[model samples]
Target: MEGIDAQRLEVKKERAPKLPVHIAKEVTKGRLLKHVEISEKSVLPTALDMYREKVDENLKGEIKTHDTSKLRHAEVVEKNVLPTSVDIAREKVPTLIVNFDTEKLKHVDPVVKIALPSVNDVVREQEEFKAGANEKGGMIHN
Candidate 1:
């Protein structure tokens, strides 16, 4: 029995359709405006205006159920802790990375130590005893 052999086929390249010279020249020239003019005549402008109006209408009274006290609490939390948390996190990454550049490390180490608060450090204490009497009806012992 003789075996049949299949030959590989070569792919042919097709030429792209050419536009007319005049039309091509007009396209290359300023006939097509670079910046689109968005006017009432454009459907895009009308659609955009309608979308904005719908959004504004839907947003109305959305905050009516919101608790103002929660906002105050959030503000307090942010004021007391957010800045410190961010500063600590920022300082922590470099310390953990271990491959800091020499000069950058020198600068960072001191700043990190100073910027971050120690857990065991005492916050404040009384300076000295006051000899004067208390004004708010409390007994003053010298």
Candidate 2:
């Protein structure tokens, strides 16, 4: 490994990752870490002086991705790809397959005429007309 001088590293004050303003001004002097902590292990910082500019580009890319996702979500709503009011109404209220309009609904004809027996017919049909009241007040017919 080649030895790198820390004194030669340059500070980029304009485009550092968003940090609290109350931090020490000296802390801002050396933007690149001498040894960065990553995955529980300390690693050497990059010699690149333009780190802040690269980070700004990354942030811009993320912003563009977020905006694109929002546009795709809007497209799903604007197009009929997602279920709409009409689709929901049609699903809820189904159309009747049997049409009553312009077509006669055949009425079920009821039994209008039934043969009823008269008093003469009932008396003539009876072979034995003997009827008397029994001891229990119920009539017995023969």
* Superposed Cα deviation of residue 14, candidate 2 (Å): 89
1-142, model 2: which lDDT tens digit per residue?
Answer: 1234332332343444757765555476776537776677677667574697788899999887785544643344455578889888777654444433645567777878988999888886553333333434666654
**Scored by CA lDDT, what does every candidate get?**
0.57, 0.62
Clashing pairs for predicted structure model 2, backbone only:
none
TM-score of each: 0.18, 0.18
- lDDT per residue, candidate 1, 9-122, as tens digits? 111112435688887677669757377877676446688899999888777756666667766443444455456877888989978779666665444444444566455443
Off by over 4 Å in 2: 1-98, 106-111, 127-142
Give each model's clash number.
0, 0
Report the Cα lDDT for residue 20, model 1: 87
RMSD of candidate 1 to the true fold? 34.2
* The best candidate in terms of lDDT: 2
* Model 1: lowest-lDDT 10 consecutive positions: 4-13
Residue 78 CA displacement from its true place in model 2, Å: 34
